[model samples]
Target: MNSQSPQTVLSGLRPTGRVHLGNYFGAVRNWVRLQEKYRCLYFVADWHALTSDYADPSKIRQATFDAVADWIAAGLDPKRSTIFLQSEVKEHAELHLLLSMITPIPWLERVPSFKDQQQELKDRDLNTFGFLGYPLLQTADVIIYRAHFVPVGEDQASHLELSREIVRRFNNFYGNVFPEPQPLFTETPKVPGLDGRKMSKSYGNTIPLTASADEIRALVMTMFTDPNRIRRQDPGNPDICNLFQFHKLFSDDATIARVDRECRTAQIGCVDDKKLLAEIMVENLRQIRARREEIDRDPSIVWDALREGNRIARQHASETLELVRKAMKIDFPELR
Candidate 1:
């Protein structure tokens, strides 16, 4: 065994069904790489999913399974990193309830996403207790693992601050039971979908990470290009083209430079450019698709991995809960 003690990192994703390119470049890929360097814990935040979709949670179970499969297919090794469902741990809820007692109501209301999500998801009735306390639950998710770092993009840094504050308050009140987890800011590239908008499932423009080659081709072919360049011979600006943005991610430097020059010189048409991108994307997704297929052939593989992860996660969570209970003088003699 390696003698060096690895720093712990924790991160979770709400089981939102399909994993798309936006999710890959924005977070999941980073999680895969971080696992190689850190003691990582990744979970399907199924309870968090209820913050907004509590009305119809029939899909959460399937979404959790699919999301786990996507994470595995994207190179999150079950052996290297703890992978489990948040709800299965049980300790998270207990910690969340305990933390809620100390958390200020105004702090929950001030979280940026709380209002933003409410306005964005106007159709959903988010004026509920679960939605308000989502950040508190997230705080519990990080601190329960005593994670040293929580990998997040800039948009999520503020949310992590809430976790830090919660930790500070908890330690102040209950006698230093947890560490404040700092944000490990990661570079999350802007991934655009077919309509030249930020890639999102709600937009119906996503190219799912597990999509077949034909599906990839079909989606890529529909991606928006330089709208002003109406003719094949018309000069186009690669900087203004959504397809060019994707090329930057999937194509080599030489291919990108050539595309940039050709598009500007009216030497490459949007149709041909899209076709080239589709081919490269198909090649890129080939290995991931193959792995997903293998996992799909035996569904037990994912479940068994998650079950093992749940056990390991429970062990750590139980230890943390014991400390928490002891700190709060809630560990009754009978229970002990």
Candidate 2:
């Protein structure tokens, strides 16, 4: 696609901690593929991180750097896609403020995550205005870029629906200055953690993307498998095995079929099966780990790319804000 007419795709991730296997298969891999066909903008959502992690804001900066490094290691090229930090572009806050004025409290309250997160994170005092209005800020994140599509998994469809509704409401009041961004649904496979649950950092069950070969093996050895397989001679169920789910992603078809048959017939043990998976996972991530090492040697690589991308993002965001001001009849010549 050419620079002038490529379809724009925008997405971001909260800078909570190091990326894990779930993140690579669920989002970053798809992003890498999208960059080849579209104009992609990926950002570290540091400000969004503050919505939930405001109690301790000290980690946001370092987390942003680490997240960007993982993105690059996972094959997101800065030359092909704009990589940035959300807080660096002040226009996002401005747009979020403007959007919040038109967005009703009831609308934000109806979001599924609003109630879900409040209950899930009962320790945090989530009654604050910032927590309530983050969805509006998320709307700003998308429409500020005037993105044609927002890549999302099925569970996030409701969040993007709110963004679309805000775009419609804004256009109804002002002129049509923003496009209603559409969802590009992604088929992300389920990546279970070592504990046989959905892989998440909060669960403390993640296998980080930058883990060493020994670490990978150690972590894989902890993965939960079929509970019925009590003895080495006992028949195992690959269908219910968490390790088998991982095998589907990293192992070849031949290996997968062999493992399935062997496990069922008592020809192989979980220890041997897990060891093979660990080896395959380490080899699969060989190049990514090497690139991560290069970035670690010089942390400036991530910062420099984000700096240039912030410049590009700011330019686009400034133009969008100007149009918004004009549409709302707030752009007075005397102010300039």
Candidate 3:
């Protein structure tokens, strides 16, 4: 890939299960907008999931399918973006092994997520080689496609920086082969869960993107509103209300204005506000729900998409591996 060409952005999500409102607002929504300007490669990171959930691998297959369906339904056009599965491309493992040789143990140890996850999953034994080497695998995932940009949130900035340092080290010894990938910081929205915590599947507070209108209504109806406003006539704070935060995103200018005015003046009760927000959310996500259902019906079609993506991904990866072999003096002309 030419350095002067349009920047290439690579991002992948682990398919634990269904994508939720946080997933949409925090990442996928930005991804949709990014595709318009940059070359995008989005993949299902099933291999990464194995690092933590190796105990039960059966669920991964279904999770990947669900994740991919959500991706397509969220407006990741197959015609523009290369949507693929990580494990399907064999070269990633190869590149990970090669990169592993050069990466220092200290670098892996310092990754914030490593310790954070270890504490989070204390019941599971995470003291394994795969856990430490996941960052190297991530490095390979990006450079294999020669991606120059990675769309990431603030929490992930360190990973991109580490990948860039690795690229620099490799280039110093083997010549300039891979361009250091830059982090494209995406400003994620504050989409809270029903309990006002960060929306996550583990928390069981997420409103899934695939949620039905009735399900959405039910979830919103149960959401926490302003606690200070004890009475219906008490002046409410929209800023403190999770339902009002959602309205800011899904509701129109007129509706938002109405909510802001009514809430401050104690005209609109929390019940009425929540019901209105639920209706807005259901209407907003209705198209994505319909599209996801349609795509999920045909299993073969999903596989076909994955196969095609694998074909496209392997072409670039193979070329990079061949170059790496040459640089490391592994390829002998006479032997070939």
Write the residue-wise lDDT of candidate 3 on 72-184 in tens digits.
88898878888899998999999899898888999988887788888877889899999888788889999988897898888779878778989999999899889899999
**Which portions of model 2 miss their true places by more than 4 Å?**
1-4
lDDT of each: 0.92, 0.92, 0.88
Per-model TM-score versus the true fold: 0.97, 0.97, 0.95
lDDT of 1: 0.92
| Model 1 segments more than 4 A misplaced | 1-3
The better candidate by lDDT, 1 or 3, is 1
For 54-77, candidate 2 gives per-residue lDDT tens digits of 989999888888899989988999
21-91 in candidate 1: lDDT tens per residue? 99999989999999989999999999999999988999999998899998999999999999999999999
How many angstroms is residue 15 displaced in model 2 relative to the true structure, after the best TM-score fit?
0.5
Cα lDDT, model 3, residue 284: 91
What range of 10 consecutive residues in model 1 has the weakest lDDT sum? 1-10
